[model samples]
Target: MFILPAALAFYRALRVYPSPVELMMIYQKTVPEPIFKIVIELTNLDVKDRVEGYYNKFPPQSLGVKVETRMVGDISKKALVLTKDVQVGEVIYKEFPIVGALDSDLQPKGLYCTQCLREVEPSMSIKSPESPVYEAVYCSQACQSLAKPQHHNLLFTLERPLPPQIPLDEITPEKLEARRKAHTQFADYLKNQAYGHSAPLLVARFIARQVASEMNKLIPGSSGIPSSQDYAGADDEEYLLADHIERLRYVEITPPQEELKLITAVLDTVLPGLDSLVTEERYSTLLGKMAYNAFGVYYDGARDDKPAPTARPEDIERTRTPMGTSRQIGSAVYTVSSYLAHSCDPNARPSFNAGNSQLHLIANRDLKAGEELTVAYVDVAQRQDESVEECRRRRRMELARGWKFACPCERCEREGTTVGSEDEENIGDESRVEKNMQRFESNEGPL
Candidate 1:
């Protein structure tokens, strides 16, 4: 890590330096430490420990931490220790960053993952099959392991990302607005603060980053983000089915509901709005028709009584099913229905992030032709035991703001999965089957 001050200066000035591994090419450096260990500590030690702790007290200290090249980032309390032998200027594994706590309703609305700090990839999300219980979300397997304990290893509901690949849509204003409004409702429910859900906030952070990226491109002269910042993520554990069904209650999709204001305004500047935007059918058929497309909207539709859906894997792939949907940036390819088709058996999903943007599109299934699309904007594993009525109520209050009713799907009726029951007042009326079955909060649980 010495010599070549001129090169170092050039690298800093350029603001576009060599790759991590490429940096190693600058020089080959090594250190020999016999019977030594690289220690990584994530303790609550304060500055006092640094200036006057045992290390300082003993001068060189007995630990014998041999001198070598330090890494890019400084060692924080929660730092990773690389063996002295491990190659430098290379990616290292450390526990993921923890953002916030779960929401009152047991959703993963508070937790945040660093990988998702700036960019929230919808494709990174996974749904749980166990039941409804939201937990912390992460960009990789490492993230999940680091966040499990905080969620109490509870098995509510689930949405686990698989190795299988699926398509996704670029984030848009319509998607943002719809997500915002829904998010506002979800937050409102948290007003009671029954149990915190980090899933919502985490998912929002995950999706919002993508939304912001797209907006900047569409608005050219703008921050690329809308008024609403937060998003309504998956539930931590409950499913207020009736509330969601009623929440998705239709009143002739207005500018407010469709988020036509920001959406249309941006579209007017460059392309057309929904009118010019391909229909759900055409969008599904033609993946590359427009420079960008909304493809779908987020409404309170569900299989167990809420207006929302299960957001299965197949549903999401329909909209982004095309082979390249995952990798494209502008006017990429995906299933049109994967974009707009609502869910009861949702195969797709969305997530929120912290930074600026809101909402994202992720696949839930393999998706077949004509398969209705859906994204699970709520948490799963945690809410497994939540009744349909409770899910509906929660959705209406948290995401829909009492604007609609619960989903009346057969699951909600026979199994009492959702909320839209004759006895809206009583949520306990429904039995808990999926609730008891749900297992892990992270993706591994589903697998």
Candidate 2:
């Protein structure tokens, strides 16, 4: 188990808070001391056991790959290293997402399974008429059953939020109305305002999943709602979902205040005090992580008729996809696949061969054991009409604009000399991890 440093204990006793500069994006004004104190307490509780030897716990042999730390200059990066030699087109592993969300445009249309994002024939799909605010349809009974217990009931339905073993206050008519109103408001907010962004819904689903996991522990002989357990190891018993999420890298994001309020309101209404699980700082970090790590789920060759975005270029949401976000039907975040770094010429590519959110890692070239697996985050293939130099610039610009990172992969390095100065000014890496995560990884104290 990871241990907290002595310095962090001292800081906790002193009640030291993060500086304004560190919180500017998340908070417009000074956070009330009480809320800030809650943030500090939550951080102290979680950071103690998140990072040290965390990657070692994943079952590498079963997954056919291991996560190893590599140094790119002074920065420590995690990479997926193959455990066995494989040829092109070989399947390395298959993973289910911890949480998945359909694209905003498709969510209300009932053309896809909200649980798996699988395309559904209207006549054959199962619809949830009980959902007051969201129109959730499933392709199968299994999808509907898994989704309701995991998150759908808590967020979208009036069903009991906790297991029978757990006691609850009487559900008065007033309480029921309040819960319905909160769910309706949050669902309407997502439908009317979320647009291209799937991060908000993904974050909500993740939080609900965590709550469900904890609640399930109250009953005997229950493993809780299955949450991407395809390769979980013995250490999973000791680690919570929060432990897995806190270690991943995140880009900074400033979500709207109303979004948080709507989500927290729903949680608080369902189970009192559950809203405390997500503070402003925590919510922002969760959103950033989801946005950074989520993969676009597409099938076949991907679609070409996605609607053009009216949002400004910088405001448009982008998921990690070689096919580009426009072509994807939905987005999902996988625990293991999150470690697969980007390459202009990748050794492995993520494929949704099952026509759902499940990810299959396919080898692009013959490889030896210990080779680092990589995938193209943005479309990196040279277009038929574009020159090599032009292709390099286009991919680099997408990386910079979408992920805030300049490519330093072997392919980019070889072509760097040919790219001229005209595009150099526009490309740069501005990506960053959360401050607490950096401190934890570096064996320092909490902020």
Candidate 3:
């Protein structure tokens, strides 16, 4: 057998089970005992590491630095208990706060999908009392489970009573109370089956009110109907005014073209500001929105100098409707998103806002607390017993209205490919000669 070097032999001797003390013994045997004793260190890491775990696990008593245990978002030692925007692709163990994150004033009404926070998809939403509203929630059972623990805490805190989200007497989004009151009236009107109550009265009334409102904006004519009435107007008009009400309709009794032009000029200047006031973020190439609305403050201020450009709530009432088609000009105004509410047939829904201030409603039959309310903006005519093709037709109408192109809704995904930039018409026939001929001959259409 070959003889191994003394140093190698010493290291090999304690190869399997090495305690620090054993390593020191090996050093003493190989090196001079005095030198080994002088240099021997309990401070050496390699020797300590080999035996550390064994001592901690098997020994009855141990002396070491105490490691403090603390609750953390992760298994790792470094962690923070604060809210942060999650990076797109980064993975992390994190938590969120759960407290009265939602308004407790309103009664719990509906449900939503926890995953998407939409109401259209069918899903089970936990039904809790509207009062002692502790939790603002998601659309689905899955969302509840996925919510960070703090989100759960918010729910627990909201377990007390609060006030209504929006008061009936207070001004809300455009036509909010008016629409709500009108809906109540319509519901009451529809309650009666006599005289084809469903035919068109509500729509007719809405249109008439819209028209009258516009007429009232003009300078007063002697007899028929005065064109412009100041904010302090007749009892009928004054009765309709909320503290911040602005007109949406008008009738021109004066036929003063100059005055109309002047009013028009003033409006062009004012409206952009009104719209910009609410914009918190950029809208495509446009500037941010009208700042969060201070109700009708701006609208009211503009009217002090000239005829208000906005339609009167009452004037649209004067117009005639197409036969059997009782159409209303006033739009539906939503309050808190009903993603906070769910329904089998939800009366209220989300209406995505548009550039022109017109909004289209969407339906979210399944929603929960804390979800933005969405409505079915798809056409009502197409909504009835309609096939998917019919629904696509309705969406096509919306596209014509200039809505966002890609539809992430569940229905849109099920249908054929949605239109995109590549589907738009070509700018020019750039291909030449043989290339042009080939392009024509090819079965696939040009992008």
On TM-score, the leading prediction is: 2
Residue 7 alpha-carbon offset, candidate 2, angstroms: 27
Query: Can you write out model 3's per-residue Cα lDDT over 1-447, one digit (the tens) per residue?
Result: 112233232332222111224445545665665444334332343343433342122111121111222222222111111122222222212111010111011112233322122342224455333312222345544444433221222112221111132112333354333333333333333333222111122222222222223322321331212211121221122122111111111111222243223222222222212122111111110100000100110111111222222433221111111110112211221111101111112233322222111222332233232233223333333456787666554454332221222233455545646564322421122112224323322321111
TM-score for all predictions? 0.22, 0.84, 0.21
Maximum-lDDT candidate: 2
What would you estimate as the lDDT of candidate 2? 0.77
Tell me the spans in candidate 1 whose CA falls farther than 4 Å from its real position: 1-345, 351-360, 380-393, 396-405, 417-447
Candidate 1 lDDT tens digits, 1-447: 222332322222111111112222221232112101110011123223422332122212221111121221221111111122222222211111212222233233332332222223555654232322233345555444423322212112122111112222444767545434443443444334332212223222322222222322222233222221121211101111111111111111111223223322322222222123322332221211221122111122211211222344222211111212221111111111112322234454542222311234344544433333343322321268786556544433321211122333333345454334343543232112112212111111111
Find the 10 residues in a row with the least total lDDT in model 1: 34-43
Q: Give the TM-score of candidate 1.
A: 0.22
Which run of 10 residues does model 2 get worst, by summed lDDT? Answer: 1-10
Compose the digit string of candidate 2's lDDT tens values, residues 1-447: 112232232223222122223433332234444545554565667555544556666644688899887776666667889999999999989988888999887899999999999999999999998894899999999899889988999998899998887678999999999999999998888887544688999999888877776566545565555653463441156555665666576777899999999999999999876675577997898898898899999998888878788888677778889998889989998878888999999999999999999899999999999999999999998999998888888888777666677678988889877656635664433434323334545653222
**TM accuracy, model 3:** 0.21
Error of 3 at 300 (Å): 30
Q: Where does candidate 3 stray beyond 4 Å?
A: 1-326, 332-366, 380-387, 400-404, 417-447
